[model samples]
Target: MEFIFLAAGLIMGLGAIGAAIGVGLLGSKLLESTARQPELGPMLQTKFFIVAGLIDAIPIIGVGIAMYLIFVVAA
Candidate 1:
């Protein structure tokens, strides 16, 4: 049971770190491209948000799962 809790915490923490790194790398590339093409700023910004949301999705789901494990399963 304690191991389950630890594993759940690790899942959420690692998920968040992975998402952050993914979004950071994506945004960096998008910014570099936008800098190269100023006219594409609007389009790139929109795409950035969509990509960011997608990157965040897994981590957010991990958080939900962690909560369930901590509050429900461990209860």
Candidate 2:
């Protein structure tokens, strides 16, 4: 039980950090792409947002699960 919470915490924290870094790098390139193609700014921005949603999905789930384990299971 203790190890489960510890592992979940580590996974959630590291996954969130990795997701943040991935999103930052991807967003930077998305910005560069938009700058290079002004007319496609809206389209590219939408796509970037979609990608951001995808990138966040797992990390958010991990966080929620970790919280559940910590509060409910640990309690």
Candidate 3:
């Protein structure tokens, strides 16, 4: 039980790091695309928000599970 929880904690932390990097890279690309085609800025911004929401969802779930394991399961 302890090892499983420990591994999950490590994986969740690493996942958070990767998620942050992924969102940063995604925003960078979105900026470049918008700069290249200024007229499509609104469309790209909307799409970026959608992708950002998707990226956030996964990490949020991982964090919630991690918290539950640490606070509730370990108790």
Best by TM-score: 1
TM-score of 2: 0.79
Q: How much lDDT does each candidate structure score?
A: 0.93, 0.89, 0.87
**Estimated TM-score for each candidate:** 0.90, 0.79, 0.80
lDDT of 2 by residue, 1-75 (tens): 879788887979899998999999999998899889999999988999899999999798888888888888878
lDDT of 3 by residue, 1-71 (tens): 78758866886988788889989999999999999999999999999999989998887888788888877
Candidate 2 residue 38 Cα shift, in angstroms, is 1.0
lDDT of 1 by residue, 1-75 (tens): 898899898989999999989999998999899989999999999999998999999999999999998999899
Worst 10 residues of 1 by lDDT: 1-10
Q: Native-vs-model 3 lDDT?
A: 0.87
How many residue pairs collide in each prediction? 0, 0, 0
Clashing pairs in 1: none
Report clash pairs, candidate 2. none
lDDT of 2 at 7: 81
Task: Pick the winner on lDDT between candidates 1 and 3.
Answer: 1
